[model samples]
Target: MDGWHDAADRFGVPRTDAVLLALNLYGLQTRLGARVRLQVSVPVGAQARTIVIAAGRPDSPFTLADSGQLFAGAELVGAAVRTDVDDAVSGYLRCWDGTAWRAATINPASRSKCTGCAPCPTSLEPTADPRLDTEDELHLLLDGLRQQLPHGGSLRDLHEITVSTACYESEDAALEAMMVLRKVLRSRRIDARIVLLSSVVRSREAFRWLAEHVGPFGLFLTADCVTRRNLILKKTKADLLPELMPALLADAREAGLDTSFTYIVGLDSTKDMEPFLSAMLPQVTLFPSLQVFQAHTPVMDGLHTPEADEFSYFLNARRIVESVMVDAANNLVPEPWRCYRSLWYESYAGQPLEGPRR
Candidate 1:
């Protein structure tokens, strides 16, 4: 309940804040397997005032003010909710539709505070000494993602892996970590691709070496924001990123390795986003892939959190890329953009690599 309330504060009315509120409340009441029903009635005349009906049995129906108007017939059967919101309204409804929760649908206009109900896993956190080695923690995190793959299946089927290595202080350590990952996958007979975080522009030798050995495989570079000034000052202090990204993408392509860049939304407050799009869209066409930014786990002191609208803008940009470049070639799907070696690597390897790359 508190979690939903906090989120509602951020997203204004006429949005999915209410749906999230209802879902969270329903989850709490039914945690013990007790069936719960929430009926929302909006008065025809009173646009602001709403009536929420919480009925569990014939004996009682609790009615409350719909200040949030979040409860609108989100019910739970013996175990699950009945009037589930469809995909169209799912984003506005905030309810998880049996498969997974949609973070993009969350309204950023609401005024709710995040409760951090689930803290990031300890293994994903930075080390205590800051200067201390993170190889052990990194392995633990990677192993965790590997454990998530379907049991008894080959690793090549697992198409995606998200890593958090972009924030690491040591690029060498990051490269070494990937090497260890490659060794592990080969041992297991799983074929998979890799998305590396952090600016590898300064470490051309390392990246070149990676291209020589792992380059035949897939590689994704994460830059969230497009401009060098903003990325260097606000997001990451690496100035060489802007120049390095294009070069790296070109190098990867020349090396026969599939490559792409990651762009985050809502990083800047400027209204005219066309310039950013202009610089990135061309790359999306020329490059192998373009991963749009979505609000995932918060990082860099919460610098990555984007307004819901901004996130939507990023998604729309991806659509533009798909329609213009990918659709033209019928390569809209990510699989086609992946490196040829990814197929062989995952087939010969086992388990998926996890965590952001540096």
Candidate 2:
């Protein structure tokens, strides 16, 4: 309970109703053994609510104000959630979907062992260091996500699965990681859309190949992108990014993928905000997310601390992007925007996100 509130206070994200149910995912792959269950038994009058679960941490639980938005580790993969609606804390209960008894098990995940990237910052799901986890230990970790659980429900039952292993440092390593999951998912029935967060956008050829072979259905967030200031920081960065970003955004849209940029607020680049939005938002089905630059990152070195007004950033971005919407009058972010679950959208704008992007 203390972990919950401390993290929520730091990040300004909402706290989950966390109950430590005493079950642990102690070396989960060795046996089909551990399952932590939760009961949803409210009056039938409460039937209209949709339940959303947030991953609670036992320690060290925040990245700036991002909250659970930035955590990844082997233990996170071991975090399985079993919604035992019918059981209901040992009394008569009904499932939210009107079934007498229904249960589905899902899990969070960790990254592969390939994890170095200068541009990519660490978050919630961090893999063990390459030296510490032996090849065998690594294999066991992958099995947590690849292997099925001991019931009708599979680990893939997770709504918006985040795959955050260290394999995305290079193009080849990224491909290798995605291929392994592709192979596992080939014959399985999967309803979930896996969001692949990667830093290796080295070439359009590589991205195009991945999109074509992997059948990545549209949506890419160029996380390392900053506007004019980024180009000034390193000219090579200009060649690699700003130009390449919009090109890929256009390419992805042509191929039917929704693409958007990431704006780092408080950077010198925030000056580019209006023009950037005017140009980019029209191309995207989903608007770009403005992230408050924490100023702690290595890339942010030598820059003054951010004096960004987050509420203003959110408001301005919304106003510009809303023009592109057919329903321009709607104050809420449209349902299709994927990053809302983790972003402080509701905190700044006073509107709850419709749902997670899956």
The parts of candidate 2 lying over 4 Å away from their true place are 1-152, 156-160, 164-167, 202-208, 227-239, 256-258, 285-289, 295-314, 323-344, 347-352, 356-358
Evaluated at residue 217, the lDDT of candidate 1 is 49
Q: Tens digit of lDDT per residue, candidate 1, span 53-130?
A: 122322221222223222233421111212221111101211122232211111111112211212112222222212
Question: Tens digits of per-residue lDDT for model 2 on 168-227?
Answer: 445686566555554444545443444454445445665576566665433444444454
TM-score of model number 2: 0.50
Per lDDT, the best of the predicted structures is: 2
- Predictions in order: lDDT: 0.35, 0.37
